[model samples]
Target: MKIIRVGEPGLERPVVVDDAGTSFDLTTLTADIDGAFLAADGIATIRRALAEGRLPTVDVSGLRQGAPVVRPHAVWCIGMNYAAHAAESGAEPPTVPVLFFKTPNTVVGPYDDVLIPRGAEKTDWEVELAVVIGRRARYLDSPADAARHIAGYTISNDVSERAFQLESSGGQWSKGKCAETFNPLGPALVPADELDAGNLRLWSRVNGEPRQDSSTADLIFSVDYLVWHLSQVAVLEPGDIINTGTPQGVALSKRFPYLRPGDVVELGIDGIGSQRQRLRPA
Candidate 1:
């Protein structure tokens, strides 16, 4: 099952598309896909509604697709979670997860325009597997506790400005990550039960040229471990997002030119879905 939102930015209507591509209006079921809905067992409720044929079918033919979830209170990110990515950045893979943040407002519709902040060079793209928290988690006993708390999976383009992040961060990475439209997430949010994130082909393309091409299997820190580890330090609230780090193909390694206005970025993760964005000056 894929949960989605369609329409203009602030007026997006909640929707759900079944395996057969039947679109159902979630307006009667909930106002929007947010923390309240997920925490209240919204996915299960939607399943039951779908089974009962109780919701109306929506004509989403021309509706714009928005980020699957509302702006999360916290957009948590993991850095260098992929071994090759760590190496490319000139560092050894960490013995533990490296954490960072992107302000909640950075979340935008999957197909929305991405802004290249003025005077910024070294803007980069990262194709990452994003985990959405469905239940409040804190001090989880083990990685096994992560599954139940995960509401679903989605694709996130962890956009960055390498200069702000590494060169001018004063040791803080969020300096580069927290820009408007920095995070393009989802064409759909697939329920966690329906997919196995352990192994999936996730890749990225910039201006039609292949950039990042890798699998989640290469992750130095697995999904469950990152969630479990983070819960020990912060409360993983429903609707919060965890960007499980990007694979090695980002421009940060200096293998390719950084993003510029007019460039197009496309990212995809099998099963979850794909997203594309056109860059323009902010």
Candidate 2:
């Protein structure tokens, strides 16, 4: 099942996209797609509803797509998790996963306009596969346990501002990562059972030129390991999002020009779908 949230921001209605690409309103089953719903076996419940033929189909032609899940409990990011990306940034691959956070407010619909923060000059883009947590996880026994806690997957553009991230902020990457609209997420949330998180092709393009083209197979820390690793320190709650990390070929690599107002960016992971964002001045 491909779950989605549709409508204007702050007023999105839960919906599910069928195999035929038709959308059905899910409000009759749940109010919003959030932590409480996932924690309560929401997906199972939705399946039951579908089997009973109780869900109402809706016309999504003119509605805007919101982030598939509502604001997660937290938005955690893995830094330098891709070997080539780490190499591009001139850092050795870490023996452990490097972590960071993008505040919840930074999340917006996948197609929303991304704002270049005021006075910002080193803004950048990253294409990452984001994991949505389905169960509360703390001190998991092993990476194998990680799969049961995953709800689904989606695409994210981990937009960054290089100067704030590296040069002026004393090495805190979140400083550059927490700007409004910095995280553009979702066209739909493909359930864990429906997609394989590993071995998927992911890519990003600025305007019409390709910049990053890589695979999740290149992740230094696999999704299972990341979930298990993070659970040992912080409690992983349902609806929490973990950005698995981006691949090589970002403006930060100095191989491409930084984004400016009027530039359009597009990115996607195979099967999950694609998203496009227009750069706009703050």
TM-score of 1: 0.99
lDDT of 1 by residue, 85-129 (tens): 999999999999999999999999999999998779889999999
In model 2, the Cα lDDT at residue 267 comes to 98
Model 2 lDDT tens row, 1-282: 789999999999999988887778899888999999998989888888877888988998978999999999899999999999999999999999999999999999999999999989999999999999999999999999999999999999999999888888887889999999999999889888888788999998899999999999999999999999999999999999999999999998888999999999999999999999999999
- Give candidate 2 regions above 4 Å deviation: none
The local lDDT score (0 to 100) that residue 58 gets in candidate 1 is 86
- Report the Cα lDDT for residue 200, model 1: 88
Q: Give me the overall lDDT of model 2.
A: 0.93
Listed in order, each prediction's TM-score against the native is 0.99, 0.99
